[model samples]
Target: MADKRLAIVHVAYGAVGQRQNRRSLSFYFEPRSFNSHTHGRDSANKEPWTTRYGAQQDLGYTGPLSFSHFPYTRCLEDPSQLFDIAIIGFPFDTTTSYRPGARFGPFAIRSGSRRQHARGYTLTWGTSPYDLGAGLHDCGDVPLSAYDNAKAIDQMEAAYTTLLSRPVLGGTNEAYKSQTAAISLDGKEHPRIVTLGGDHTIVIHFDAHLDTWPPSGTTGQERITHGTFFAVAAEENLMTNTSIHAGIRCKMAGIQDVEHDDAVGFQVISTDDIDDYGINNIVKKIRQRIGNSPVYLSLDIDVVDPALAPATGTPETGGWTTREVKRIIRGLSGLNFVGADIVEVAPAYDSADVTGIAAADIVHDFLTMLQLAEPPVPHKGPFSLEDLKYP
Candidate 1:
């Protein structure tokens, strides 16, 4: 009986060894010699595939047509339409002071923002601008035909005036053709315009620089280059007296230029101020200055350090980091932001779309902050740092 049991054990062990030998031979199907480039689709197939003689090509197909694909929430085009916010692209960059190409800002920004709407919901704010009950729309770029600076400026202002109250398409309201009454939101009329830039110059009436100079050879409209739009905007009574300019790093003509800035109701904050007084204090001061008045937030891409944002025409050194600027802007939530803009994104100067991505994110934050007026959502519990890391 002992001899018979030993023979059976030996047979079982021999069978297991034969199975291991077969498993080892299986690697022959996937040779280690071939480079990835030379590896074809049939490399893993045991049976050889027949080669095709004709040229390999994919048949193209047409899809449904749409106006534009927005990175944020989108609405249908409606004339005389009142929404919480409207995105207007001002693609006229002919008036740049240092570098040109900001005319492409709106297009680049839109492209960058393509991924945002997918992740628009956030833990910090607990809601998105789309959920705030007010509607949002992307009014495509204003058809700015003028190459002349003054004519371009007039076109932008006229377009802005028309967009403020009426639809991008003509509306029925005769009174609202060039003027719009403020729409009520959160107990206040806060229908707003969020403009993508043609250049930093388009911020003319909106900031401290009225683009004034000390009488040079350039005369009349020529004098009003990109730097002087603010002066015209102020003269037109288009700007609110409580406006503020952030990230003013470039030199002015003199102290008088600054005086003119203050004279036109702008409280300027330089990138240097962020280092002097912390971001929180700067934000507090901004909130104090802006108060409950309707506000227009303008962000120039050059405001960021060139190391982080090198795509703008005017590359300034020692500027704010993207994180710092975002924190400052985010801190100003709950303020009545009636209009805003992210300007000076020249993609031709940009490498790897860094400037475009930053511009898109800034606009995303602006949109997010617009909805932060409501109460915060309760935290669910602890999440690890690794859990929140980017993909």
Candidate 2:
């Protein structure tokens, strides 16, 4: 059977209903590699990138329109329009303890994402979700002032708050929660908004900002609930909780000491410890903790090997392999998340723009797959490691 184990695991979402039946003829396409952005053309046979982009004078095409300009709106940056998912930027680099230029993250991510979208590097391809009907928009960087990070976070928060309520191209409302009426403009809730960042500190403060929403948006506060942002979000009493910290290794007193507190309510599979403990098991732990809820993913480029993302601020060594990171992302599929972001890319450090491109590709693949996966899992009992099949 050609060693079915790897076969089944490698498929682009071939399994459904039961694991055994997924042994169909396909098992080698990650959602990204599925080639959605082929723009309805064949992947391998489509025009070559350079020639298609008109960079190659040798294999030139003298068409009136340029292939490079096909996606036309690559750098389209602005907000105020609605998207089921919107990309907001927080360009602050001061919080980084090491390198000092993550502020350029949004631009790089945008550029990368644009390139991938132009090519066939995404599965969800277009902006609207086929399974759930959500609209997505790349509403570039959130307006921020360099000197005031807190104020910047507030502005970022306000931007997301706006996105979470705006009507998307006149589609159905995609509001995640509105218990406290956290974000209401003109008396209507917007779509679910995702935020890209300038740095990791944005995550901590965003975690803080989520507290404004009511727990479960139904009744009295239990003091700790999923409405929060941290993995201990419930413990912290914020919205959209359950955090999995990938590509990070630090023992700062403030963050690590809480691990001793069983009630801390958040779980992090730090890349340092996860690599030491074995990635597969860590993947199992991540699957266990997040379950099948609406999660919001935050990826700092430093989480990958510096070689893979050398342009990020606070570059960490021994980060996850590109495949390892991709696996983590895939494992999170079939999940309903509010949004995702990749930050800490400083193109100034890398003229080649490798990190930015990878970040863009990763984000695009995730967002695209999010739009392609089966609808929100039936809120049944949590799935276990046993749910996996290896034959």
lDDT of each: 0.62, 0.51
Instruction: Quote the lDDT for 231 in model 2.
Output: 33
Model 2 CA deviation exceeding 4 Å by range: 1-80, 121-134, 170-190, 201-236, 239-242, 251-263, 272-281, 374-391
lDDT of 1 by residue, 162-224 (tens): 656443333332222222233233342334677887754112122223343422322553555
Model 1 segments beyond 4 Å from truth? Answer: 1-68, 71-83, 167-190, 200-221, 374-391
lDDT of 2 by residue, 166-242 (tens): 45454333333231123333545345544455543112121111222233332453322222224333444553445
